[model samples]
Every structure is written in C-alpha cells, then in structure tokens.
Target chain A: MRYETLREQIIALELGRRERQFIPIGLSAIDDALQGGLDLGAMHEVTGPAAVFFTQMILRQKRGGAFWLATSSPNEEYYPPGMAQYGGQPEEVISVCLPDTKDLLKVAYEVLAANVVGCVLLEVQKPLTQTQMRKLQIAVQNTDSLGLVTRGAHTGTTSPERESACGSAITRWYVTVVDWSHEKTQIELYLVKNRRGSPCRWIVEIDHATYDLHLVSVSGE
Target chain B: MQRMICIWFPFLESERLIRQNHDLATRPFALVMREANRAFVSALSRNAGNMGFAPGMSLADVRAAAPDMLYFDADPMRDIRCLQGLLRWASRFTPRVSRGGGHNLYLDIAGASHLFGGEDVLLEKIETQLEDFGFTTRLALADSKAAAWGFTHFGSTKSNITTERLEGAARELPVEALRLSYASTALCQRLGLKKIGELTKLSRVALTSRLGLDGVCRIDRFFGRTAEVTEFARHKKRLIEEEQFFDPLATNAGVEAALERMLEKLCQRLSGMRQGVRKSQLQLDRVDHETMFFSIQLTRPSIDVNLLKRLFLHHFDQIDVGFGIDRLILVAEQVAPLSCHQLSLENSQTQNREQDLEKLINELSNMVGARYVQRFFPVDSHIPERTFSRVAALYASRLEEWQSPSGTRPLRILKKPVSVLLRDGIEKMAPETVFWHGRKCHLTPLSGPERIEPDWWRDDPDWRSGGRDYWWAKADFGALLWLYRVSDEEKTQWFVHGLGS
Candidate 1:
C-alpha cells in the first residue's frame, strides 16, 4: 500500500511539472528561441546599461502586481513617471527599498516564495553565490511567479566561468543600447544562457508611446 | 435603588504578573514597592499570603521567613491599565461601568442583568470569566456603590445583598467597611467603635462632632441615607482574542501554532461583527516578565485567517522567547466594516488573483516594513522631482491618475543631479562636449531644451539654481542621458539628471 501511495505521489509531481506555463515576451523570434517563451516559474537575470528598461518591458506583459526591490542608495532612484512610459502602472507596482544587498535578496526570496505577485525584480549591487541564487531558484520553482534580477552597473564583466558557476537561473540576458534617437530607442538583448534552447540575440525597438517592443533584427542562434 | 457590582482584584499587581507568566502562579510571588529606599511587599499571591507573608511587611523579613519567594518591583501604572482593560471587558455585561480606584471596577448594572439570565448568573459569569483570564476576583452586588464596595472587600468573595439585607449586612461588617480616612478609622478603633452597627447606635451630632462631617457622611452613604456619585468610565470594547498556555512555548512552531489558533478565533469574531482588521497587534508574554510585540498591517481590511497567519509567521524568527512564552494576545487595533460580497461564478479566478496580490503586498510589507514598501502617486507639481511621491503601499487607497508631462521623462532619474563640466566655454545654446562620471564625452542634442521652473513659493536647495532647460542628449557611446543646464547669475551650470533609455 505504501509503494502504491508513493507511485501515485510521483505521478502527481510529474503532472505538476507538465502543467507549468510559459510567459511569452511578445516577440516571435525570441519566443521561438525560448521554447515558446520564458518559463513562468523560474529565475531570469538581466544586466547592462539598459537592463532596467528591458526588465520593465518584460514585466509589462504579465497580468498581476509586480514588486521591484532596490537598495536605499541615493543613486538607485526609480522614476515612476518614466516607468509609466514603459506600460507599468504607477499604482500596480510595489517598490521596496532595502538598506543593503543581503536584505534585498532576503525580501526577494520572501516575495518569490509567496507566489502571489506575477513578477519580482531585484536590483542587486553585489555578486551572488551559487547557493544564494539556488535558494531563489528553488523559491520560484513551484509557483507561477517570475524572479527577474538585474545586476548593478559597477559590477564588472560577466565571464563564462562565473556564468556557469551561478547557473541556477533558467535564462540570462545581457542588454545593451544599440541606437538612440528622438524617434525610437533600440536595445540589443544577448541570451547568453538558456537552459532549454540555444543562445541567440535580438535587436528590438522600444515604442515610447504605446510602450511596446518591436523586433528589428535577429541573429546568431 | 440602583444595583451596583464591585469587582475587586485583591492581588492586582502579583496576579497581573502571574497572568503573563503562569509559572509564577505555582510559586510564591510578591510585588514590592520601595519607599525611602526600603522595600515592602505591596501585593502578594494567595500562596505567598498562606506562607505568612502580608502586604506592608518588610521584604527582608519575608526573605528571612521564606527564602524561596520570587518578587518584582510593583508597577502601579501597569496595574491601573490592567484594571481599565478589565473594565472595558466587563462592559459587555453592562454599559454603565466605572473604575473605583486602582484595582477595583464598579459596574452599575441597574437593569441590564436579564440579558445574561439574572443577577446571580451575571455575577457568576463575571467571576468565571475573570478567573479564566487568571485573575482572582472578589465580586459583590448590592444596592449602593459603598455597600457593594464594602461587601467585596470585607463581606464575601461573591455576595448578592438586597435592600432588605443591606442594613444587616452593613451592621455585621467592621468600621473599615465604611471606607473612611485612615485617621477616622484609627479614631474609631480607639473609641471602641468596631462595627458599623455600633457606629450607627451613636447619636448623629455625637458622631459628627467626634468623627467629622466627612466620616459621618461615609457612614450615612453606606446605609443609603445619602447618594454616592460615580464617574462612569468611557470604556470601548475591542476585538481581541488571547490564550494562556499551561506550559510555556519555547519553539517557533509552538508559538506559530498558538498564533494560528488565536488568529482563527479573532477572524471569526471579526466576521461575526461584519468588520475586517486593518491593523492588528500580537503580544507575547514571556516567562521572564518581558513582552515581545509585533504589529501587522494590511493593504486592505481583511478577515481572512490564512492571510493574517502568513503575514505573522513571516516574522516568527524575530520572536526571542526569553525563557518561554506563556500567553499570546491578539488585538485588532484598527478595523473597518467589510460589506459582504457575493462570489461571482465566472469571475472567481479574477477575485482569487486579486486576493493573492493583496496577500503578496501584505507579506512584503511585513517582511521589510510597511513604510519601505510603497506605491507611487502623481502630484500636481511642475518640478521634476516633485512631480511624483511614494506612498506606503498599505495606505495608498485612492491614487491620482498619472498624467505624463509634455516633455519625455527618462526611465531612471538621479536622486540628485550630477554636475557636468563643459570643455568649451558657455558660449553656445548647448555644450557640444561635457565631462560626466569622470569621462569626457561628446554630446549630440537629440530633443530639446524643455524649460522647467522650480516652484517659487518653496525653498528648494536642489532647484536654487533657478530654472533649467532640459535636453535629451546622446553620448558618443550611444547612451541617452537627460541633461539640463541651469544659468545662474555668475555662470551657466549643466547637470546630467537622468538616463533616457
């Protein structure tokens, strides 16, 4: 009887894994490379100069409340009116300010574990260990929540070994501004690590009026 | 005749300590008050009293007699607050409740007795509830406040004295039952007047001349000859639930279990009242006479026990159980009426999602702090930084619709603008090259010199450089920066305020 109960429990666990959904990024090429889209209950890392804008754009696609965690440093100011330009409602976004990186990650873990909000964005200034990243990964694994982490600008280059060391995140993207003009701003997203598919790059134009992402070019799968 | 009930807590201070830490109830406990650097027993438990320790006895003598006695400094203010809380709790039995001194509560249940059966049942109910709360109370019901006070102190633990028996009851009690001044009691004892009946046998003029008018009036008031006025306490009943444990809880799981049960009871009470809690406080009384307090606030009033439990358990690690926690009290400090909503058959998923969002907000608010988690609201101001304000997420009810400014704002704005150095002198409308972040970069003005002036009425240090002409400029590295130039009297200063992309 115990063996049969254990077998039934394993079946339920498998079904839960199969039922996990994917949140599409609204770009066909990028979504195709991501195997339909980003896994709904997983961690994704974004880093670079335009990483905040890219993260905000991805958060705009989700349906529920979003939490943005940042440190209390004077340099880390998030302009809500500017964020509204990226289709994030000022009222729907809950901004949390912690005193340090440790508290930022702690609150991020709590927010992800609750599985209530649709997305959590952590502005981490320091590098995280594999254990820290793995803890956050496990927190969001069972919930329909997305954990989006953006590294600080001062943190130097992301080497391949360091990327492989902290491989708990399901996907990692490096954002760079390609073009800026009065009409539109274009950013290049480099998918350095994808657990499910090959790495690729996509150039997208940000619509300031409608706050939508338009695909311009795709390269290097 | 008005019916009055006087419930006197004989060992108020010691019992309050015992109520908080139940382990002290089994031991000999006393509360000491120091006068002129000499400690004296102010209150003693029944066990300590049985061990021959009395109030007003020197602590040194008590320690010599009973070396195993545990004592603490008496806090009269906390005792008074406890009495006031009991008064509020007793208001459920009758609305006309008043405090008769530090450790006594007077209930003027003139006609409000039938709701809980009759007078005897009401008195019994009050006694049982107080006992359940770990208070040893002596309750008495009589026709007058003086008579009720006299009976509770000197007559019986529980007594119902009628108008016909009031005279005889007063006759049997001692002269101290009249509650006279200390000098009058001493004089009465010296004059061989031991009982109220003996004092009443004396002539009125003789009594007045010997004991003074106030003392004579005290005797008159006891026998219903004169009316006694009492100031009723304006007691407001709170939605509260609490539990006392036989064994103190030393583990987080035990505390969480007790908290969960208390939350269930409190939520049920709130639901019965058709109200929801907006802010609630949890107090843990440790075995060492210390208290740990936590306050949980919600984004919206909620009666959901699971949400409250989750919010509270998130902070369970912070509870330092000094020795152990013997009592848990949950009080809803702020509540609002929650109108019942019929669940929509089709849109229940949406409702559940919204509820989930609220739970997330509450949990995040508690994890950091309510003030640290905030939502932004637009303000009707023209200043760049003053255009929006961050309000705590839990308290942001009605937010103004965000109206985009005419000029395009940047995705990230610097908290304080950084000054930029222009290589070329301030001759042109805009500088071609500027040094920022210790790097000299060429600037190409993409969009414009949108003029923004500071609020003239307010003194702002950041905006003291007068009006600024903001420009969306591009650096040589293809990064968009929000640059603004402030032309002061002496020189033209340029500052990079934000990042555009």
Candidate 2:
C-alpha cells in the first residue's frame, strides 16, 4: 500500500455517488454540461485562442488563496493589475515565477500536493504523459482544491492524436474566439473530453461591465 | 481585584556570567569582587554552593577549600542591563510591568489573569519562558505587593495567595522580606527576633526605642497595617535587548538564534505597549570588539514577531562577525500605537490569507530581484505605458483605483513601437499592405484616425517627434495591432504601437 497522506485521505472520502462541489462560473449551460461545476481536486485542461479569458474568469470564481505558477514567457506572463481589473483579487493571488526551465512541471507537482494553498494554476505548452497524469489524477482525485493547467492556442504544427487520444484531464476544453470587439467578446468552448458525460460545445458571451461570463446558447458544432 | 506579581531572579550577577560562559553551568565557579586589596565571593554557581562556597566569603577561604575552582569578576552594570531585558520580556504578560530595583520585576496584573487562562497558568507561562532563557526564578502573586515580594525573596519560590490570607503569608516570612538595612536585620537577628511574627509581638514603642521608626514601619508594611510605597522604575522607551558571550558564536545560525531572542524581547515590549515597530536595527558585537549593524525601515508599523524574524533572516549572512560575535543587540528606534481591530473568527481566515500574501510578496521580492515581481500604479499621463507606472512589489501599497481607458486597449502592448513602411508609395491614406519590420504585412483598418494632438506647453519627448493619428488594424493571423502615423505630412510615418487581445 502507498503511504496515505491528508490529501489522499480527502480524495478517498470523496469517493461516492455524490458530485463534487464547484465554484460557479456564473454561466448556466457551461455549468450544466460540466456535471454541475468545476471540481477542486481534478485538473481542468483549458486550451484555445480564447482560453486565457475563460481561465481568468474561472480563476476569479475560486474564492480563496491561489498559487499561480507563472514563467518569463512574454505572452504567457500574467499581469497583476490587469488580472485584478478583470475581477480577480490581486492580493489574495500569489504568483510563483519560475526561471526559464523544464523543472516547472516538477515544481507544479510539489505545489499541488502540498495543500497549503486553495488553488494551483500552471501554464504550459505541452500536455502531461499518461504516467504523469495518472499520478496527478490520484493526487487530487477527490479534494476540494481546483488544479488548472493551461496550454496556449495550438498552432497547426503540433499533433493532437498523441494527447487527445486518451485525455487524462477530468475535463478538457478548447476555446476559440467567435466574436471579439470593444463592445462585446464571445467565445465558443468545445468540450473535447469529459469524464462525467459526453463532449459538447457552448457559445458564451462575456459581460463587458462586470466581466461575468454567460452562455448565449448551445451549438451542435 | 488588583493583584501584584513579583518575579524574583536570584543571583542575577552569577547567572549573567554563566550565560556568557555556558561552560561554567556544570562546573563549580564563583563570581568575586575586590574590596580594599582583598577578593570576596559575590555570587556562586550551583556546584560551588553544593561544594560549600557562599557569597561574601573571603576568596582566600574559598580558595583554601577548593583550590581548583574557577572564579570570574562580577560586573554589576552588566547584571542590571540583563535584568532590564527580563523586565521587557515580562511586559508581554501585562503592560503595568515595572522593575523593583536590582533583581525583582513587578507587574500589576489586576484583571489580566483571565486573558492568560488564570493566575496559575500565567505564572506557569512566566516560569517556562524564563527557563527557556536559562534563568531560575521565584514567582509569587498576592493582593499586596509587599506580600508578593515577601513570599518571593524571603519565604518560598511559589506563592499564589488571595488578599484575605495576606497577613498569614507575611507572618511566616522572615524579616528579609522587609528589605531592611544590614544593620537592622543583624540587630533583629541578634535580639532573638528573626521572623516577622516574632517581632510583631513586641510593643511598637519598644520596637521603636531599639530600631527606630524605619524598622517599625517595615514591620507594619509587611503586616499590611501600613502601605508599602515601592518606587517603581520608570519604563525605558529606548527598548534594546542584548546577549553577551564569552566564547563568541561562530556560525550564522547561532547569530540568527541570538538575534531572534533579541527581536522576541523587543517585539514583546512593543506589543505590551500596544505599539508597533516602525524602524529597528540589529547590532552584532564581535569578540574583537567590532560592531556590525543591520537596520530596517517600514512604511507601516508592525509588531509581528515572525515577520521581523523573516526580514532579519535575509540579512543574517551579511553580518561580518570577524572573530565570532560575542554580543547581539536589537533596538526599536521608532514605534507607533497599533490600531485596534474588531477581531472575529470569520475574518481570521481572511486575516491569515492577507498575512500569508504579504509574507509571500516579501520573500518573492527577495528571491528574484525586486524588478521581476512588479505591480503597476496609475500615473497621470496620456501615453499608454505612462498611464500606469511599474513599482517594485515591495513598495506597492493598497491600490486606490485605476481609471479604465475610454476606448478599448490592447492586452499586450509592445514596449517600443515597430515602424511600419508603405508597400509602394508614401501617399496612401491607409496601407493595404505594409512592409512591417521583416515581413510584408497586410493591414485592414477596423477603426481609424483618432487624431491626438501634441501638448505644446510641456517639452514632451515621446510626442516631440510630432502629433499622431491612431488606428486599430488587423494583420495576417488575425493579430490586432494599434497603428499610429505622425501628424506631420512630411514625416507621415506609421508604426505598430501595441497588440490587442
């Protein structure tokens, strides 16, 4: 038997027919398709052109101490004031900036399992392997901590067959800009993978004033 | 009910010496003082006492008894300073804490007992904390200060008595509790009247006839018949805590521990005063008599001990204790009263989260250079980047408010504008295709020509090139760019200023 820690014990206690509690993303269609809402313990992989907007929206919802694993990547870096302006509590959010290195993944693992924080978010270009995902799955399988991993918009160069073949995430989403302008911004989220139900797509519009997201309608596409 | 607490520190001089030389703790040693070309024992360690050496004994007699025993010179000034440090440490329990001459600390813990569980728990805490600092103490609490002092110095080590039983406790204690002059005590001892009870039976007139009004008043004070007016030492505002060593501490960790001890005492005193440290410094005195100092200045005052410890940890390495540090000192240069907050269990989590965030910011700013962790504050300017100015994470205070731009702004604005070039000629109204940098970029205008005029009043550098017309455009791959052209027709140059989400 593996050494059972507090996190593992929490995960074990969550094993039942009851669904996990989630912080509301302020949207009905997305929340309904998400098997109620975002689970704290499970990894929700968000990838697409408009993923940063939705990720920030989801982050503003996780109401507690959050650890953001950021890098020096020019486009990937998280701006504090901008994030705060987008309805996130900048003071409650602490960003762990890592030097340019691959060890960020390993560091992310340690940070996730520590349980000293309420949420963990890591930005990466690549997805995890089956072994790494399996380890992460067991680590947060049943806790009330939101773990998020974000992959930037995939340029046509990378292959989807390798990672999308058997998605290890509890839920995997791909977002694309349907309509973006100063007056309004709309994103189409394709639910590429879901552990609890079938994959689907939802068109959502972000309220310019409050930044709260709302689903306009569901699309078969 | 008003209760008096007396903290009795016995043989403080000897303890101070032993603290500097911990090697003497287990050995038989005596602290000696020279008087008229003759050395007399002033204080003796536990082992020396067991071997039959007592204070005031001639050094020659002590030497005859144990020729191999060690002896150190007693510094009365050092003993007083160490006692002051203990007084500051005790102030954490009650703000009405004061010194009672050389070795006793007095605290008026009237209604403060309940705050620390009770009188018994409070006393136990004092004992434990003192023990941690390598001191042995006798503690007593009573309704009268004289009774507490009597129990502590002359009677027993532990005495927690109610006001009703103050007479009985005082009667059992000897005349030493009165703290009388040596001649008076000796005169009483020779008269077959040593304990206070024995002297109480004598007529007041008779007692006065022999020992005068001072002696009779001492007895009345002990019996609670007359009030004992103890001239409490005025509190020293310049709170400085220090520790000395005979064999200097060689490692940085050792210095850190000593510095922590000093900080704990200093912070405790500030907290007792309901004050926070605004500026403080740590001084490390080396064995070779060189002093090293590290100081910190805070924008807002704080009394958090752990926060002070963490801040000092960063500078622990820079302290050059050349020949090992023999002394550590901490001084609170400036302090301000801590504002009261209505504490609640619900807000405890929020409070802890805020504290953790502050700590993380401090540590992160220290880990990476402060520039890497930055927060932007608003500045009154028309330039996009100048609208908000970057400040070090360490210095960013509570942000008041940020004015949102009237129009849409780019998500990622480039630091420098990339100059755009016309594909065929410079006379075009808007470039259908432009040689932007290395690539032949095609630009389709989404919004155009928001003319911005230059402010001729001020000598502006960025706008000095000329006034510009701004446009939001889209290039290949749907990249949104903010393009601007110089207002001057002769130099109608276009440049990509920023990128939109």
Candidate 1, B-chain TM: 0.57
lDDT of 2 by residue, B58-146 (tens): 99999998999998888888888898888778777887887786588888899888999999899989988888888889989987677
Clashing pairs in 2: A40-A145
Worst 10 residues of 2 chain A by lDDT: A154-163
Off by over 4 Å in 2: A1-19, A41-51, A59-176, A188-203, A207-220, B1-240, B248-253, B279-300, B314-334, B344-356, B359-376, B391-399, B419-444, B454-460, B474-479, B487-494
Q: By summed lDDT, which 10 consecutive residues of candidate 2 chain B come out lowest? A: B363-372
> Across residues A1-221, which tens digit of lDDT does each residue of candidate 2 receive?
25435444444353321455667667877777665777767778877645667677777777775767656554434444455546666554555556653545555665566554577777776666777766665666555677887776423222222337255677787766555656566767777886655778788888767776777778864
**Per-model TM against the reference:** 0.65, 0.51
Q: Report lDDT (Cα) of residue B84, candidate 2.
A: 83
Q: Compared with the true structure, what per-residue lDDT tens digits does model 1 show for residues A1-221?
A: 79656654553353235454788988888888886888777788887656776787777888677888889885758887887665677677788997878887888887888887788888877657778887887787788888898874511244322444236777888776777765578888888887656777888988777666799988553
TM-score of chain A of 1: 0.84
Q: What is the lDDT of residue B229 in candidate 1?
A: 89
